[model samples]
Target: MFSIVEAIRQRATPQAVALVQKDRTLSYESLFQQCDALAAMIQQHVPHDPARVDRLRIGVHFPSSLDYVPLALATLAAGACFVPIPDELADEEKRDLATRTGMDAVLVLETLAGWLPEGTQKLGAFSVAEQKVLIQRLPAVTPGFPAAAFEGINPAFIRFSSGTTGKSKGVLLSHESLLERITAANEGLRIGPGDRVLWVLPMAHHFAVSIVLYLYHGATTIIEETHMGEDLLRAGAEQKATVMYGSPVHYRQLVEAPPVGEWTTLRLAVATAAALDAATAEKFRARFGRDLVQGLGIIELGLPVLNLTGAQEAPEAIGLPLSAYECLLKDDTGREPPAGEPGEICLRGKGMFDAYLDPWMPRAEALDAEGWFTTGDLGRRDAAGRVTICGRKKTLINVGGMKVFPEEVERVLDSHPKVQRSLVEARLHPLYGEVPIVRYIASPEGAPTTMELRNHCRAHLAGYKIPLLFSAVPQLPLTASGKLKRA
Candidate 1:
């Protein structure tokens, strides 16, 4: 089985730029050395029971800085699973995660030192001066210990699903699973050396975590402290970034903003986390002279499918499945649906997570037998093998006897000029079982009344498909990964 730590060691070289920030850059060699030093420091101070050492779970609390990378590498190097606690999470949520994961220790930055639970061992931030002191003050631990060996099925990382419907569940990912999934994505996307990537999304999200596959291919990654539109465009030009990935929100801003004609180094742009509207996609392509590849992957299945090179073949499609993944759209009876028939999306592949951690207090059922993970997304495949997502299964609204998909209504609402963003949710109705309601964010200095929105939808949708109520809000509640939360 491949070890993530060993992969880093072999790949590290002085000439390879592994990390870049606003003011500084660290080569692969420096990154590896820092990780090694921190690994030794952790080994020296943390008590390890021989029997439990191999299964140690370590919680990490740090910002997306240079130090965070090495610390994460060191955790894996020390034969432990690293759980990243995003700084934006509430204090109670952080503690709850650490407690639920049964983390042996919490490695925290100085700024978050007080947030850790009592009795948790903390690792101080390693500065140049602190590194020297750690090496001098702490006794040297064994440096040449054999790296942890495991089967291909051994769990590597336990990522929690964004708790949109309920409490979060930990999704266990194995070494071979992640490696194969990422390799397939890298190959399919054609990411390679010399390709500079501007990473602005939160690292905690699987979308950002998938970038590690690019690093393995010798691509350079530039981390941005903030994700403002102008800052991202400026950094892309400054870093000569070739590949950029973000949500539709980011892409909408980029295409709508002032033109940057000279920023031509960008060759590939990817948008995920939510569906990319066709109109917006066309606008982006018209401005950049390059089509934005819309990637289709679920958190439960890692990033097994991509629509990179073949997006233009089917403008409304969500690309083809990755080489390692086998996808099937099945009806309620578990029978395969004919082409163009909408059904639940099912996947069986190496990229699929082993199991979801039980979130209920006493632990509850998470996965079913046969290992076919059912992604609750409703979609259909065309004759040419292109997948077009229709709506979410749980987000369907039942108006009397008719079934209404909120996404269909939301898409129409979003197309309006006065609507900045919109969400369609099912609300309980007295006569009808449930009716669809429209909530939207208005464009700057622009507000459209309920009747205007209704008229806009009436032009595109049937009578039953139209929302019964319209509400305007500044912003809709979203999960950490930016997916719309089901009401």
Candidate 2:
């Protein structure tokens, strides 16, 4: 199979610009050259086993920036799997991810490279895309899943669907899978060589698929460092950006703080990673004259549902699945839901994930008895086949579009001496859609003060995962089987 990088090189014009980050712009030829340089450095510096057929697992820990793009591409081009280390993750959380994925080495920015072990000899520092970065060799450790299983499908990226907790499923996507989904998504997006996308999302979380899509299609990606509304508009105007791919929070910022002038160049603005509020949708349309299309992007399945034709009519709808995808809404009885009624969203598409990395469940085993991959989300379908997400059935909570897992938070709370057991659940908020709240049974000694519990959690969890409210409860609700009741 032709590597995705090779495919990008095939269609791209050498001198045409491919990336714009603030003042720097890289032409297609320059981007490819940098990626090649990094790939060579990775092969030489990062350890590899000639005896093992499995690919090297390379972790990337960096802030939201353009430098991340080349490292990710170079990792993939070198036949290594890319695992992103999100900057928001705490120190312990970062260590957990590295161990869970069995990452061989991590390419980290100068200041962000503190996750390294003590007394290890580090590889020589290298520069890519004119930004200096360090390479640290990790102590050899085995991951939860077998190496052969991961290598079987030619894996490209393995990222957790939510947290890196024991219960969290590590989504494994192959090189072929990335190529397929991006091709399918672009059928509706129609992103091509001429389109420039104004992007603000962190590359670590989004680069594997979204960035690959743009590069594969020969579109220019403009990296606007700030999410500030005025800055985004200025960059869009200066770069002639044709697309805006960001979350609702970013769009709301654009709406609340009106820029001096409108971005007349944008033809499509997609709101993803969270539910798009109608207020932000309508206000953005009124201000910028571009419809805010909402798309459902899941790690298990690459972007399958996008609001292509119905955004102007119903801003809340997730719209129809692409022609290449088949979407099903299943009820509790394991049958299709009634017309215009909510059900658990299930999907089958061209580029579904290969397997769940931890505990080793393949796509065949992960799917429902009828064979569709059931997303733990609830939504309804209209007569015309347009759909909108209504609720979540899983313990995962979306805090301003970032995922916060209840089990991960509960683990931290349970570790405290003052807490015996804890339950975490999502509370609906007008702006954030949902925030995590905790209810716990205090230890026999007595309940800890809310301030004390907050400080205790702060040390272990990210700020977003820190529970919004902590309530002392006599007992947590239990189901008939004695399992903790999850609502």
Candidate 3:
């Protein structure tokens, strides 16, 4: 299979603007040239034999910056696997990932020196020194998993799950999978050369489908470094961005008061990484006159479902499966659920993930005989065929055999003007198997009292589904992808 860099290069023109960050601009031609240069630099440090099965793996430990894009592309272009080590990770977490991936080297800038965990040597080069980047060598360790088998797939990227509800596993993707998913996703997004996408999500979490897709389709990407409402609005307006790809948190903050001025250029806004509450959708529609198209974007499957058909009418739904994918709501017996009933969401499509890295499970083992991958999400489809996510299957609360989807309860609590966000977890109980307890972050105006929250839930939720306790916390934890962490 050909490299992703080759696909991007075929569509690039010397004068075409590919990326914009603040005042800096990178032309498409220059981007490809820089990638090749960096790839050569990395190869000098970690040489390769084209015939070898176990290829080099390089971890990129950079922040969300312009340089990050080129660095990742370079790794893939060099015929090595690209792994992202999120900067938000603690030192121990960082060290654990390095060990788990069996990465030969980590690329870091000199500005962030002396921060990495021990057992790294300097593998410096003149070209890398010019950019203040260091190739930190890691101790060689024999991988417990099948490294040769993993490398046989022409792997391009490896990113770990957030471990939000369970133990995290490294998700692996090959160059071919990336290309296929981008093709499938664009059949819905319809992103073209004229489109300018405004991006605020971290590059580490979003690059596989987002940045790579835009570049492959010859679309310009305007990077908004700051998520501040005013800053985002200013950048979107100044850059004349036509599309916005961000998380639900970014959309919610933009709808808040103090009125960040308008950017009339936006025609489409996609909210992912978390559930988009109905309240935020209505407010965003009123303020921006554009629907917040909620989509289900999993690492395993790129963009299988999008709210293109019912964004305005059924804002809570994640729309239908894309043309290239088939989504199923299967009960425990692996049959379709009763009409209007919820079940575990399963998908059959092209571009599914290749393997689980740490445990070394192949895609053939991950999928069933029918080629369906069971997503842990519990979802229901309406008469219109639009699917709405109920909650995680593992996160469903069992209160004396009564089912409680935490998302259902949290949706009611989030509608309160005085609450920012909340988490509902199962707690032990004498009469019931477990009861839901809420830990929340209150708005600046102060939390509505316990009675107020309970009354609100009572109005919207079933009596059994209402949380038993409400405790305010300074903040809730978020995964590297900017979604709430259930674990």
Candidate 4:
């Protein structure tokens, strides 16, 4: 795999559309120039430690824009670790990220300049009257100077986990590991220069970076700042996006909207971060005339595995392992489970992260000697070698000694015609010890009764697996990555 900077330089072209946001479109050359300027400016203002000046840590808080991409690339060019703070994060959370990462400085768009925490220097997008004096007082970099040389093992990014279960942890990625994961995903998706990708997912997520692999192929990337259903559809149609990547929540919204008909330029769509239910998958095909490609990914590992092209035949399966990864299902005894038996899903991959940052503190843990990282997911492999995820190991419910997967009940509930959305959580039951309680959102005009949903579940799941209690909510809580919060 090529270094990210080298890949960008080689693939640069005049006609390539590097970014397409709401008001403007930028060419690859323009984007490159901006990155170069940003890199030079960053090098000038940020004070470098004598011993570690070659490597800096910069926190960036900005909306998705053509400018933001270059700022990120520029940070990497300067041999610095780029930490992206999501725009949706609370002020306290944003400050915590900066303090926790030991950021030497922060980069922000002009609008967000006031949100910077105290005791940190803020670099505005452009020089201003108030900021000019400070900008002038800093050291300057020579124009057109080359970026600092970095080894493949150098830290490129410090990405925070979604923190749905708890506080987010920072997962460090080296250039080699990041590149390997991009290569694996590119190979699995068969991404190429001709592909025009619409990027609507949050850029802070690892899966979003998967789209960067397209740069190596000289592909155009259309950025949608908002994940609103209308914005996604309009961008796809107007930009003629050939490929799109998003979460299941995004797909559900698109399908539920009024008819948009078939998208002529669309060739493939990838959905991750959450389970792509069969009903939702079918709705996507019916609305767009294309199957929403589903894959498995974890913050601990990049795109280590993906389903094959025709693997949508079993939409529930996570498909085959990529060349760089080996996946297995292990029983409680640590032995591989036989086909058709459920076990813990474990992965071994070249693209896997070196360690997981401690959520409560700053330390990390390396992988065990076995090389496999337990995914905390329960799954089973079929005779054909395809894997189907049952549910999260910790989220499983035990009902009077019978094992129950809340996801199974939730899927059944979501499949109901009147159900808009649903979530299944385990609750303590006096008689059963623990049982599944489902919280759902229903269509405003056509809501179904709890007994009706219970009957619906009976058709697909065993009695013990069905939710014993049901409640309605206006909307479900979601994490920063856009996945539903199970707890």
Candidate 5:
């Protein structure tokens, strides 16, 4: 029965600064009041009658802002499951999510009111005075609604998967499960009342484990809405931010930008949502004197692995499992793979997600018989039990009888001084079944010729792993979360 709202209340009574933006600061008391006010407004739309036919499902569509925190907490406090519809998504995708979740209502910024579907009632409006945000709501659609399967599970939030390769699924988490995840993640993060987290990732995608972890542990969170490196560095230094969570793209920008000031208070810079390239890690450490610790974050699991110890020594290793989880690598037949042999990464953890919202894909059907969730990632553990992720099992390239991972080749291309970023993919070849091709963004100075790139790869990789062709692109496609999207 651990409540996230109650935890925030206990910490905010001290009147500390809980959240910070450029010029906006939200004290704990102000944050609590906003959450309370929003909760009351939400209760007006949801029926409290015990005999109600379905549980309330509320969708939140807003940009990354300080107001987002209170609205989400308020939704949960009002006994409605919170589903975030990112503003970057296309209108059709947003509507599809709302329809699939059977959302009972939606809360959006006043400026975006016209985006809601037609034939929906305008319930009412509310203002968050502290953040100066006006919000409106619309009623849900009842298109042959099924019995509310979610009420039985009592989910606190429903998050969609990254959908890099296929349609996304809704991953459910209860209040208790969220608490467990924060507690477990903090065991490694070691956050406290004095620490401040510099956050730049999209709130819609990363709020659950990251923002919640800082709040639960009484840490301040400095929100930077823009991806501009100067803004991020200024806030981190001025606010004396102790920790930072960003993707590899953000880290690269930080490395390339000129120094703002000495970040004496910053201790940890975590890179998640995608693989960490060795080149990025080296440049970041060389410039800032801090290792960019690579971590693995899955929708089904909060954060099971982090490279805390080996960031400088083994920049590519995802490190060992967190204290609260057990991890192993298994071959396709469910047999344990030998040490250093690549296999699918499987994990069982206390903070694992509860269910999938799709009725056709139940939780039991998704997990294995042993209760271990088989992550589609492919990795191998060294003698010291450190795991290095090679690539996704679904994305493996087969050439002749050998298996080649694109990441293995992409790392080489990224290491080139003239290459900014690179993506590797498979192409059909009548002779070898399939061969790898490299698509890259070259540095403004000049890019090496294709033959030079191939020779560089030949020096580092086996002949089968060397890419057959190299093509220059303005930029490779990336998901909203900043993970490289391979097609």
Candidate 6:
């Protein structure tokens, strides 16, 4: 029942830098004031009755910035559930998501005019809106639309799953669950008031766990405009950043950038969103004089597993499960597998999600009878209890930290008039750990060119979801049951 708002309200270090953008710095006192103002305004739009406050579902759509920090805190401070919507999503997708999630309204930027569907009513473009927060209502609610089940749990946040197989569902988390995960994760991160985190991850995708951990622990968060190597290095040096969390793509850019000044302030660098190859790790170590820590982050679970010690030598190993968490590798029969034997990764920890937002799909289904959540990733445990991820039960391709599902891409490719059948698989990339390479069988009369297929995919899918290479095959490999055989 305890929310993070209480922690923000008790700002022990009032004058300390809480949030930092390129040239702007917001002190803890200022952040607290802004959150209070925003929360007060938000409360005006909701039912005055305190009992009805927690039922409001508000969507936050924006890029990462200093301003976004308070808006998110304010949403929770108002006793409402915050749903993060990525900025790059197509408008059609946004409308559909709003409908599926039964969102009451979306808080967007003023520049993003015409975001809602035609004829949708525009409400409070609040005069007190500091971060350009505009709320827009949907046209009409569907009859008997199921409301999210938050009967016993205090739902605080909802985020979309990676949608590796098909449509993405909402993963719901409560304040207590989030607080538990962040507290558990920080046993390894060790962030505090003296530490400054150089943040480059998008707010929509990662803010809940990472940024909240930094703020909750009284760490300064530094945000830069661009992820370019020069800018990142400059910001780290200027801001005295002690910790940095980014993707492989961001690290690759830093590794390729010319050596600026020695990064003496940086103590820990965490790599998430993709696999870290030996070459990239070596180059980063040579450049920064520090090993890149690989982390396993899931929406349902908080940061439970991280590679802290093995990053320098065995970068492939995902290290041991962090403190306050339990992990298991089980075989098909649900028995613990032998050491070094590959099995599905299962976890038992404090920060488990509250529920899936899809009203029909209960949260109980995701957890086993014994309360362990089976992460679909296949891995092996060593004698030291270290984990090495071998493959995934789900075929979600990590294209430079963006999750791209082959089924989603194949659906677009199969819809092409000149395409008969299609298959999508991961191809190794030096920079991006893996990219989707597509193989398709075209119609006999006129085979579509690779460019044509790429264009077709681009129209329907996100840019990262577009296939890097395309091949026209006489026929696609099929299994005995006639399903497309994936390598």
lDDT of each: 0.70, 0.83, 0.86, 0.71, 0.81, 0.79
Question: With candidate 3 superimposed using the best TM-score fit, by how many Å does residue 393's alpha carbon deviate from the native?
Answer: 0.4
Of the candidates shown, which would achieve the greatest lDDT relative to the real structure?
Answer: 3
Clashing pairs in 6: none
What clash count goes with each model? 0, 0, 0, 0, 0, 0
Per residue, candidate 2 scores C-alpha lDDT tens digits across 358-401 of: 77899999987777988877788887788888655566688998
| TM-score to native of every candidate shown | 0.86, 0.81, 0.94, 0.85, 0.91, 0.80
Q: List the residue pairs that clash in candidate 4.
A: none
RMSD of 4: 5.5
> In model 2, which runs have C-alpha deviations exceeding 4 angstroms?
128-131, 163-166, 395-487
Give, for candidate 6, the lowest lDDT window spanning 10 residues.
143-152
Query: Can you write out model 4's per-residue Cα lDDT over 211-262, one digit (the tens) per residue?
Result: 4577666787788877777777877887889998778888878777654544
lDDT by residue (351-430, candidate 6, tens digit) is: 88877766545567778998888887878888777897766667767778766667667868977999988888998899
Estimate the lDDT of model 1.
0.70
Q: On residues 62-107, what C-alpha lDDT tens digit does candidate 1 reach at each position?
A: 6666556777777677766767777777777777766666665656
Go through the candidates in order and give the C-alpha RMSD of each one to the true structure.
Answer: 5.4, 9.8, 2.2, 5.5, 2.7, 9.5
Where is the poorest 10-residue window by lDDT in model 2? Answer: 478-487
lDDT of 5 by residue, 423-454 (tens): 89999999999999889999999888988898
> How well is each residue in 245-302 modelled by candidate 3, as lDDT tens digits?
8888888788874555568989899998788888889999998899999999999999
Of 3 and 5, the candidate ranking higher by TM-score: 3
Candidate 4 wrong stretches, greater than 4 Å? 1-3, 113-115, 123-153, 206-208, 225-234, 255-262, 286-289, 359-365, 416-421, 429-432, 440-450, 471-478
Which residue segments of model 1 deviate by more than 4 Å?
118-125, 128-153, 207-209, 359-370, 417-421, 428-432, 440-447, 472-476
